[model samples]
Target chain A: MNNVNLNEDQQDCLQEIINVAMGQASDQLARYLDTFVYLKVPSIEQVSAQHLSDTLKYEAQSVAVVSQGFFGYEGIRGEALLMYQPKDSDRLADLLGYEPDELSVEEQIIDLSSILTTTFLNVFASQIDNQMSYSAPRLLFSSNADNNTSSQSSISEHIQHNSFNWDTALKVKISYQVTDYSFNCDMILLIPESAIINITSVIDRILEEY
Target chain B: MSANPFCTTIAEQLNTGILILDLDYNIVEWNRFFAIHAHKDAKEVIGKNVFTAFPELPQKWFERKLSSVIQLNTQSFCSWEQRHHLFELSHTRPITTDSHFMAQNCTFLPIETDKVISHICILIEDVTDVCHYQTKLNKVLDELAKANRIDGLTQVFNRKHWEECLDKEFSRARRYDHGLALIMFDLDHFKLLNDTYGHQCGDTVLIETAQKISSLLRLCDQFGRYGGEEFAAILPETDLIGAVDVAERICKEIEKLVIKFQDKDIRISTSVGVATINPNDKRYEDLISNADLALYEAKATGRNKVCSAKEIEYILEE
Candidate 1:
């Protein structure tokens, strides 16, 4: 199948599953921030690795990107990325109750990303009745040209440099907001083509049971 | 009254200190280890708010953490590196170091009863020794890295570090289309000076020269000892005219330098060569070589003078 397109009903099912996972992730964040966290409806699409940048585009000139991989049985595996503008790194560090230093600032960002990605990934795995193993989170720097022109190409170059290659990817974009601190983050989940077959089969079973 | 015998036994004997706090932040129960380390009796601490017992605690942060555990029913953790200690407890081993306080890693977990979160348990782990050793190792590594970049005698950057800096600045300048300048100079007849006044006087002269040149350069300028009796400076965003101006000032300043050794006043001078980054230069080393050629010209055409790379090239063509 050149294009793996889900029908309207299947798409609705996938979105509902993602909504539950996003709720758990936001609850974790709300507790830490002592504020309510709001998440937008996740949008899902199937695109090639070459078009992954288009599916996951943000307007920030400088961003801190963090990624972690999770594995499930029957050849099911995927990675999630949490990215946000680093302009508020200082304020976020203070809000997280961390000492003001370069290393501490970096660690706080990593901690935030880890908590979000791991919580959401685990909850999704549980809802699907799959046991998932997680890898340590890694931080990556995403920078645009100094002139802020042609950011799309720069982002593509960065993705290519990281050697992320797959025939297809299930791209999901979920935006989170904390109203108190005016904080915004983009959580992008990319499931490889090989894992989609397993996920859809599980969804089919759920449909049959219902 | 506690209802579970096994739970009480584990709490009393566990090495990790544990404290249970009610929703009002009052201490409900504590382990033996917690009581001992805190230097407080169980009878004295129970029913008292934790903030009252430990006034030094970060109340804002602590309250937020406790509220999170209670509201979200999830565990929260803080590393020793993030916050040294939630409670100011004395170090068990006094002889370890001068630090009187213990480093702790704390975890807060919700205690649920009948499907409702009743209390929050705080677990404290002492990591003083590990933290102290880590701090010592980082200090040693920083000192080693600093020593690597400095010349043994002059205390200025060594040749390796200076070249690295120049290469970095060169690329930045080329990328942004900015100007850069290099200055290469050596003492006048340094070999003869060592022969006449002995190597000891020569050492003093080199040390005094390094100090003189360093005081004249700005912090933005990268100054280093290129080799024995030879020095170089890299100036970013400076053109040939600006480089020449700096070279002339250094020449005049060094001409007046007086080195007093064993009741003898020694005088010395330096010949300086200047080169600015030009379109013809492919790399930073190209600038270095051009400046070196200019320095040779300054020495041949009467020492104790300043020469520019373009001037030397013009004279050679004549």
Candidate 2:
């Protein structure tokens, strides 16, 4: 757990694989919502669990968050988190064909996040030659501005537990935003030290092939 | 399909509900707990499509959920809190539970055979008790929050909460330079009525008076019990004339109200003082003090009536 020092070739291979996976995820999301989704090139970095909370600059203080964990046969293991501000929840609910209210907003977010997370994780796992079993999608963060319950602490706890108490772990950020809309969602995948080793070997095989 | 005695015994005897479904969603195995809850024996459900057995199941969503589990080869969960219940099985204790359907927390685990998932095992745990208690707890918490902001006797905003609203209105008025008014009123002989009858009769009077005044005010008005025998209201976007009109309406309504308490009829009146925001006033408390001065003018001149702070200012100028 010293550091995740990926060589130039390995980084390129990982990024290329992530691009295809992320593209598939976006395509599925666009079709499901019937709107255009603009995605950034997914970035992979190594970060400590403690600094993980402060790692991303959150646009809104209160956000709706959906997280799901995936366990695979061939070393693909991690938790995927989808975060977005629920300010434009009315707009989102409209797209989902629901009257915008607290419950509808929550329901819509959970449904949309599951679609994004499932498509992304399934494609990513398949690319790495791994078959995954996904945990049910959970709305872990409260979107209530008045509710300042320890949401940050809960998220950090999930990150810590999923990282398996690794001193440092590889964090892959797959961020997206809707075109001509106010929605910005980021999907983060935390790969614990053990899973990273498995991924590295898979990467090496692909590298050997090319 | 294991014919092992221990596996069979534990599967049949264990309290937990268990069901195994193949990739095609055919019921490969249904344990005793599951069969009992689903109201179908193993022989009835086994080798049947789940949707065929339970037509109430949302087919499309269920199909998508099952496919996600199989394709990922990953375990997924459905909690009672999220979707209420997956199977919609009737509650076992119909007499005890108000719920028609028992709440269930289902776990979908892909049963891997040689690194290939052909079937999925679903574990359903009855969480009816948890949902019931959690709902009750949430209701109690909501009532507790309402109790903190409301006066139990009058059922209006209490003094602390009323003042908070006034402060907010005061700042909003200053920022937007909008019209804001305050009305303070108290029962003229509330103490005499309590002494003659009892505190319960006095309580009835306060409750009725508050209801009457609240009915007269606009939706934007914040009405509350300020103190003993006294009530206050913050009228947003109201001028002196509008404030006086509302005060007069409350005054006349209270004067007309006759509460038929137990063996007697009790009648009471209120002295209302109206005040508007002045340019010189530094805080919302100044508005309250001005309204208090107008209330004093109404009480000093005669008992049951409405007096305006503007009238007091005109008297001072003369």
Best by DockQ: 2
Question: Where is model 2 chain A poorest over a 10-residue stretch in terms of lDDT?
Answer: A145-154
On residues A70-150, what C-alpha lDDT tens digit does candidate 1 reach at each position?
Answer: 788767788888887865454665555545552355556656665666567767777888766666565554442232223
Estimate, for each residue in A1-210, the C-alpha lDDT of model 2 and write its tens digit: 543567788889999999998888677667656778878988888877666756433422456667788788767688887887656454766554344552345556776676677677777778877766677677766544334233333443454345325567778888778865677778888887778877888899999988
Candidate 1, residue B137: the lDDT equals 63
What TM-score should be assigned to candidate 2?
0.71
In model 1 chain B, the worst 10-residue window by lDDT is B68-77
Error of 1 at A210 (Å): 8.0
Tens digits of per-residue lDDT, candidate 1, B1-318, equal: 278989888888887888899999999988888888899877679999999887888787678657656755555566676567889887666796766788987778778789699999888988888788867865665566667778988888999989999999999989999999999989999999999989999999989999999999989999999999999999999999999999999999999999898999999999999998888889889999999999998998999999999998898799
Q: For candidate 2, what is the lDDT?
A: 0.79
Supply the DockQ value of model 1: 0.11
Interface RMSD of each: 8.9, 6.0
How many residue pairs in model 2 have overlapping backbones? 7
Give model 2's DockQ, 2 decimals.
0.15
Q: In model 1, where do residues sit more than 4 Å from their true spots?
A: A1-19, A27-90, A93-210, B1-6, B196-200, B261-264, B313-318
- Model 2 CAPRI quality: incorrect
